[model samples]
Target: MRECDPRIVLGLHRSRYERRILTSALDLGVDAIDTSFNYHGFSAHTALATAGSDLLPRFKISTKVGFFPTAGQAEHSLDPDRLREAVERSIRDLGRAPDLVFLHNPERSLTGSSAAAQDRLGMACAAVERAAAEGLCGGWGISSWDPRPLPRLVDGTLPRPDAVMVRAGLLAGIDVLEASEALAARWDLNPSQLWGMSPFGGSATQPLWGKLDPRVFIQSPHDGLSAVQATFRVAYWLPRVGRISVGTDSPTHLGELVDALRYEANLDNLSTYRRLLCEQRDRQPL
Candidate 1:
């Protein structure tokens, strides 16, 4: 919701609208918040801390690093200074150590090549190490679009991360089912626990506000509304799959998340979900 609306950013940072909205959203059973070091110039951290009396035990917060200027300067370069600044400010703003601090890397033009990606990945790793040493977070990790290269990139050289967040929706690169299983096997991770961000892609048609309706996603095949079902289905079958951490550049998507969770109560739909997984696997290009 914060990403989707400039108003949301404004409301959270400059006005009182967010307090009521946030309280309501938190009441809706969201177990966590993946906030940023740069969001709303520390107000997010402040609100979370102040609201802790009301919301802390209910929702875990996972903040990010590497971005700057919060709203407009998201794609800026990742540097040690920016990284350290974010960590210190976040700990101060939130008034507590974050449960997790993700070493965020916005999609850079350099990610396609092995050397550039590793260099970029290395910077993130160093930032995490710095934050961890300072006791700003419980653990540090990376978020990736593709996990195919992750094992090679992160497996042996640096300290093993406690967690990894990645994109695994139908619109994403990896085979969702296989990716979940492989990550668990290779990393000795619980597939259920991996953070699944942007189950939908950043397509324009997805609404940013109002009651979220999945039907609105019909135009964009890769929208989060479309992918969340796949995410839910996969998790239903892969019960060990941990929390489905979702984010959006739109508030309507937040509403969609609420709608999805409303009906996703049953965990016994394994047979149908397995069929869906097999269908996706068969359709992947060689």
Candidate 2:
């Protein structure tokens, strides 16, 4: 894979500030934009369509398939026909084919027997492959909320991803960092091929920087950096993380993140912080 600048992928969730956030991200030189077919009941893609016509060629675009949000709840089904419809709808809604299309969250679709789960996954993967071949998408991947299927992917039991998005962060409480490292090694994949989402654990509810203990930063070499900056550095500095996706509606907040990326983290200090975070997690009760 060709190496590029460390990427900041803007995540477009269901927010009223979609246009503003997308515009700000483009101005700040974000390498990619991630959205879903069902985000804001498909309004997210429409927003991108309006703003991204001139900008789409400048960045990689990724979206998810297999789920559609409704008034009451999301309709989830990974039947091949549904998957194809979803991808086609996304392409139409976004006004361009996605560079990468992902299976929204296959784990949720898995139930009952392991054999049944495998069959479902195979069908989904096949649908994604067909989409890629048909020019609906450049490639296919998985955005897994659950890591259980990752090992199968790594070991060749499941389909390999052109890109994999998983939750990872500076906090040791997040297990995907380790899993990502191992999977990358097994597949000989570059960091760019492994996109790390939620660098600050769960950006939606509790921002990681706010939850971090103040004492963790004490005795650190990167002392001048704020907790948020330090957190971004740690995630950015990870060897196997090619891109970090952050979601925020404020242009000022986006600018702050862009500025933070300019500073490099001290390796030794980063290691120590990881150790401290692990210890903190251990101290918590199960």
Of the candidates shown, which would achieve the greatest TM-score relative to the real structure?
Answer: 2
**What are the TM-scores, per candidate, against the unseen true structure?**
0.61, 0.82
TM-score of 1: 0.61
List CA RMSD, all candidates: 8.2, 4.1
lDDT, candidate 1, 46-81, per-residue tens: 765765446554556677776677464555556767
Q: Where does candidate 2 stray beyond 4 Å? A: 1-6, 172-174, 204-224, 237-239, 269-286
lDDT of each: 0.55, 0.71
**Structural RMSD, model 2:** 4.1
How many residue-pair clashes does candidate 1 contain? 9
TM-score (C-alpha) between model 2 and the true structure: 0.82
lDDT of 1 at 196: 61
